[model samples]
Structure formats: structure tokens, C-alpha cells
Target: MTTLIETFAALSDPTRLDVIERLMAEGELPAGALVENTQMSAPAMSRHLKVLRHAGLVEQRVAGTSRLYSVRPEALKAIADWTMDHRTFWEAGMARLDAHLALEEGEGE
Candidate 1:
């Protein structure tokens, strides 16, 4: 799994974020396939992949002469876990706001 800081930093870029979203949605793809339909140059895409790989957000596999890329499941799980850790805070805040609104509506009636 990737360190939280590194994972967030890697995802902070729009291109990198899109790359991750694509991989997650489409499953493993050849590195070249990732650049298809994108405006980024091959070299630029390659650099983004390298950054993700270093951050442990992506894994690469050699298939013949091609390199296939995919999102690291553990890295994604780490992110989900981090967000879940804050779920209670947000849920409680929403509950309090809902109650406050309900009280205000009652007083206005």
C-alpha cells in the first residue's frame, strides 16, 4: 500500500487522477492504451505513470514488449479507509445540522 501522503500527492494532479479513474473503471490496460484518446503526449503520460508507480498507486507488468498498467488495489483501499475514518465526523455534523433545522422549522410554525 502507498503512504497516505504520497497517494494523495499523486492523485492531486488532474491527469494522474483521470488516469487512476480510468484504470479503476476499465481494469488493466496496456500503457499505450492509457494514452489513447488523451491530449497528453506519450512522454508526459509516461512520466505520470512513473510518478504513480513510485507512489505505489499503480503497478506495471511486462507483457511481451508492452507494459501494462493497473491501479494498486491496496492503494485504493488505503484511501477508502482514510475517508471512512472521518465518516463519523461528517455524519455527526450532518445529523446535528438536520436537528437544528428541524427545531427552527418548528419555531417558525
Candidate 2:
């Protein structure tokens, strides 16, 4: 499995990001289907898929001659877990900022 840093790096590319978003929204898709929606050449799309697979963000299954790809739930869950772990800190900071903004607005009024 790839680390969080690798996952983030893979998703940093717009093409790979689009692929991840599509798989999450549309569920499992074959390689050919993914190519159809993009302006990228088939080879370029394949390379992006390879990067996603290596980063553990997506998994591929062989169905006869075709390769089907889908977002790995565990991978996505890992990201969610990381964010939730930091939730309290950011939430508190945002609340403080919101309060400050409210005070400023009241003073302006």
C-alpha cells in the first residue's frame, strides 16, 4: 500500500484527479470507458491509471481480456481518517476566526 504522501502526489495531477472523481461517482469502470470521457490519448490515460493504482487510490481487476478499475474504499477511508483525526484543531480555529469576523462586522455596523 502507498503512503498518504504518495496518494496525494498521485491525485495532484488533474488527469489522475479526474479519474479518481469519475470512479468514485460512477463506480467500477473498464479502462476503455475511462478513455472515452477524456481528451487524453489512451496511452496517457493508461499512465494516469497506473499512477493511481500504484498510489493505492484505485484497484484493478481482470475480467477476461479487460481491466476494470474502481476506487479503493480502504484508501479513501484512510484519507478520511487522517482528516477526522485533525478535525478538532481546524474546527476550533475556524470557530475562532468566525467569531473575530463577526466582531469586526458588528464594529463596522
Pairs of residues at least 3 apart in sequence or in different chains that clash in candidate 1 = none
Clashes of each: 0, 0
lDDT of 2 by residue, 52-93 (tens): 999899999999989999999888888898999999999999
Q: Judge candidate 1 at residue 29 and give its lDDT.
A: 87
lDDT of each residue in 1-109, candidate 1, tens digit only: 4589999999999999999999999999888998886998989999999999999999999999899999999998998998899999989999999999999999995
Model 2 stretches astray by more than 4 angstroms: none
- In candidate 1, stretches whose alpha carbon ends up further than 4 angstroms from where it belongs are 101-109
The global C-alpha lDDT for each of the candidates, from Candidate 1 onward, is: 0.92, 0.92
Error of 2 at 16 (Å): 1.0
- The prediction achieving the highest lDDT against the true structure is 1
